[model samples]
Target chain A: MDAPTDQAPALVLGLDVGGTSTRALVATADGVRVGAGRAAGGNPTGLGPARAAAAQADAVGQALSGLDPAAVRYVVLGLAGGAALPSGEDMPAGEAFARVWERAGLSCPVEYQGDALIAFVAGTDRPEGSLLLSGTGAVAIAVKDRAMAARSDGHGWLLGDRGSGFWLGRQAVVAAMAELDGEGPPTVLTGLVIESLSLGGAVPGTESASVFPEGAAPVPASPASSASASPAGPIAAPIAARDLVTAVMSQPPPNLARLAPLLATACAAGDRVAEGIADRAAAYLAATLSAVRGPAAATPIVLAGSILTNPTPVAARVRTALAERWPDAVVTPALDGAAAAVWLALDRFGRPPSPAVRERLFSVSTAS
Target chain B: MDAPTDQAPALVLGLDVGGTSTRALVATADGVRVGAGRAAGGNPTGLGPARAAAAQADAVGQALSGLDPAAVRYVVLGLAGGAALPSGEDMPAGEAFARVWERAGLSCPVEYQGDALIAFVAGTDRPEGSLLLSGTGAVAIAVKDRAMAARSDGHGWLLGDRGSGFWLGRQAVVAAMAELDGEGPPTVLTGLVIESLSLGGAVPGTESASVFPEGAAPVPASPASSASASPAGPIAAPIAARDLVTAVMSQPPPNLARLAPLLATACAAGDRVAEGIADRAAAYLAATLSAVRGPAAATPIVLAGSILTNPTPVAARVRTALAERWPDAVVTPALDGAAAAVWLALDRFGRPPSPAVRERLFSVSTAS
Candidate 1:
């Protein structure tokens, strides 16, 4: 059924919609990429329905630009937060995609799927396996015959999502606070986080300029002269732990997730606190995997998302931890999700891509 | 210096500013309460500066409505988020409170103190002790001479605040989600939380009202004819775990704290999941206390905030856990924080109240 087709050229469109960025690919049935486009977040669950649909249209339009839209035989949208519509509604996510498809003037038959299923397929051609994701959120999904069967811990940041990028970043900030207040062992994370946030010695009232005694002669502001003149130059001032905390607290809450990479860097530099956070994240990911794996035998476990795919200490720890549990588990990183959607679309349209085509698709998509 | 004053019968005012409520009390130096007022949240750090000051002024004006403002010799404010000014500037919190005081036209000298310090004073007359607060947030502070000397785990909802009311509530939701998705054991908390949130049979498209087959008679929408209506009456439809999760996700994130009491109720009713959450909360609280205690000898440990004072399983577990480690330590519930501030003001003004006066103040404040 997945044999290479020698018929006249037909194209398929695949879209990976997420909270941060959306990517779309147009490729031929032989796995040769024809065009691609990118846009901002298109997850309807994250960014409301109208914006989500518009983003999808923009990406799809760009991908199909100058190309014959009529030549596209099928479209597959692999969307994050697409498993369920906004709460209290029972409309299938497919119906919403169909409306967007019609509005976009694309006559191709379109199918919608959860991003996790696409990620699993991106990693392997297996009919059944498991996918562990650790991006801004964490969850493990057991895939049976290319569909989600069982799941664990994708409860978002508020509930679980343990071992996720947000979780690690939050831990980094927590450790920094503890060290700042002398409640825990001093860690380099305190300094690194402060610097990462660009919080210097400019604390109000305590800044060198404001701390001068009344009627005291003002010292020259140059770093070298000021140090000798007043013995209280900005260079001499220490960063207050509370000030660092206040700086962090002032940021929009979700921005805390931005600190995850700094934590990874600190872990590589041998910061105990960062290493601890990494280890805990790995352990959590393992536990999530264990919960979802169930009785499945030596199936491939595809690791997806930034926290798992990135070359960070956490990814290394997770790989090591999972290796100890399921030695025979075919652990692999997911290929490009949009391309995976293309493969699924081909399969659903009764013309699955052959292994050679799959390789070509993965290579072409990954290179781009 | 420690004697009660009969010299002018001067009065003192105390204000306890919290996230949920602002409480103010006016009384004589000898501890005879004269007036009190209540208002919405006054935590400047939680609520913005303008609203926080307005709440303080409003509560103060009400408490002093019939009293002579000139008779008030001193004022002390015990504020939850008053220790640190909002991020960005260096102005001390005292200056901010002073502006509010001047605006309210109170001539008395005012002092501002952290809520934890006042809670310690409220529990005992000692100049030093430890305070453990578990409200919407949790923290432990070691107080020495009415000043915060050491602290642990007040990092707010994003970073720490473990074992807090918010933490417990978040855990409850996590458990409910886990149970709903077959990721964990089912418990009564799943039902209780869904009911508490009022998320019943209203799951958008999946509700009975919307689930009717196309072209089928709606059955007159009568309860008797509905197969789902049965012994449970109009509430026969079991809440879909997905729907409950959707409902919670739809709410403002902080509202998750409202689920804590429901969890406590479930624990009291013998739900294992609720009990587990309670146990974790207690353990986290204990760890926070341990981190802040530091080699102190027989110092009173004042447990303040609703989570600690309320008769919940977490509070009980905390008491038991503390008793095992600090048998010699005096465990006391904090008296009214506003009243404690009054006592501190009197002491600072060289008109310390006697033991009998302290008792009178506590009785009057608590009774109100």
Candidate 2:
């Protein structure tokens, strides 16, 4: 291939491909951002490589709309679940990345990185630290020299992921079911569940039935409508419990994570059961983080994901627990993933971005 | 409907309808078995009323073949999860039962009983007792005067059923995933899981990658063929772990129960992890049983369902644990459910059968 030698490249491409969404950015060698684009999630593990590659390409194509491909030099992409791929020539969405760049008409050596390293780099420039993330799922990773050294408890929903949004949501549903069945003590979660699932009205034809091994009785529910008014635990019409169960069993298990938002509302209303769940979630999260962290606690522990990033009782409790356990650890939020990815692309070329350039990218990403 | 009134009717219909299968029995008032039939499960809660009614009709029709429906003096239909239905004309698969009788051209009143009571009646002529059942699911029921007085933890898969087959199977899968991931201690469970799920081979194209919130690394596994032969924890080719996860995720959650049979083989081979799981399962089952039992220990507790009735480590442990907790509690096996339903029908007519008749029905049922 014939090429003109430019002393300084005008643009470098950086991408943060996540399970829910994919983002792309193009910036100058000196880290002055020029373009950004977004697309649907491109998690290769969840949504195979072809679909994932398509998303990555769409985002990259948009970001490079007005920019010339020949002007782009260094390129780097950070992908979630990148470590789960096969090695070397097939590393970290290897073929998917190839398709993305080829379709975008860009020719440059692309540095593919895993989410852990990218997230670590996103929060701090430090080479060694740890990361604890609690989103729909949860995981703890120890990073050393810009690479994932060790990790724990990201085993998916069927295996582990304790203290995750899915876990909390499951707890909420289980509690509501138990309370309405008279198999558990009263809890505000039951009322919230009735209200949330819209189980307040009569079920169409019959009361819901759950399987039992012996001496079964159809569930006990009066013909009366639901009385889910009080947060202190109103005795709901058992019919509501039946409806609640039907609604839950009808969907995929991961959808339970959607119920996680109910906890915040319950916690605000002083629901003890909600409070208890939050405490347990914090404990579980702390334990998972510690499993990968070992004895050293004096590193920057970047907290990421909605559960840790948002303002909830779970978040507050987790922060407190982490502080108590790792007194010397500096807890930081992962601010700007795509921008941080750009910083890594710059670092890969032996040219670190100035503090001002890093700030500029970080500020813009958060603002957006 | 026109019917011949035979003095001292010669036959009665009894059925045990479950989620997996529906068993129907036709016997003389003196307890001589005339006919028997079984068909696909007719659980209205799971299969819906119309389809469930169809299964019941099929089984009843088969049992009534070559027999005059006019000779039937009493009928009892026992259904699992019968308590969860609406009352009156809709009582206990009400329409489903009506369809069965109408289709059969039988005018006799069809009595509907719950599985708990039928299972309890299967083992005893007495009225007050308790039942502990562990099949695909688990439940505890207290029977007083031949009715369910109190119950606990039969809340289905999502909420509870702690020591049920579903629970044990889930635990086995989770433990296996953990061992292979190196997040937990190495156990024979990993090899068993690999063998059971047919995951010993490579996943078609992927080294299965699970979702993680942050600091993730794709799983670590080698390209070598699976070495799942060693029972005491072989470091399997990571590719096998990838396949194991993919297999587990592909099926419906309850299908995990299919893997439960693997535990018996592992326990026999002296796998510590397998033994631990069985013990824990037994403990949970016992606790659930104890919850509804209160302080009374002299009441007979009929241990019904596959996990308790079958000869496995879980069963043995549960028997021993129950004995230790309630020395005076007579633990009996529920011999034949359909036969028991017939007996209950006889009891309802104020005609407690002779010991010879009970023995004959019970023996005939076991033989079938």
Please identify model 2 stretches exceeding 4 Å from their true place: A1-26, A39-61, A68-117, A181-185, A201-244, A265-272, A345-354, A366-368, B1-10, B44-57, B68-114, B201-236, B239-243, B265-272, B345-354, B366-368
- The 10-residue segment of model 1 chain A with minimum total lDDT is A218-227
Error of 2 at A201 (Å): 7.6
Interface RMSD of each: 3.5, 3.9
**In candidate 2, residue B254 scores what lDDT?**
68
Give me the runs in candidate 1 sitting further than 4 Å from their true place: A1-9, A82-99, A201-245, A366-368, B1-9, B82-99, B201-244, B366-368
Could you tell me how far off, in angstroms, the CA of residue A118 lies in candidate 2 after the best superposition?
3.9
Model 2's C-alpha root-mean-square deviation from the true structure amounts to 8.7
Please give, for residues A1-368, the per-residue lDDT of candidate 2 as tens digits.
23334553568888888877999988876678888889999878778888898999888888887777878877777777621423224464576668778877788878877676677888887878998877777778888877778777766666567888888998998877766666565665665565556554322122222211124322222212223323232332445444565687777677788888878877876767788999999999998888888675698999877788889888899899888888888999887788888888877766777887787777777223
CA-based DockQ, model 2? 0.21
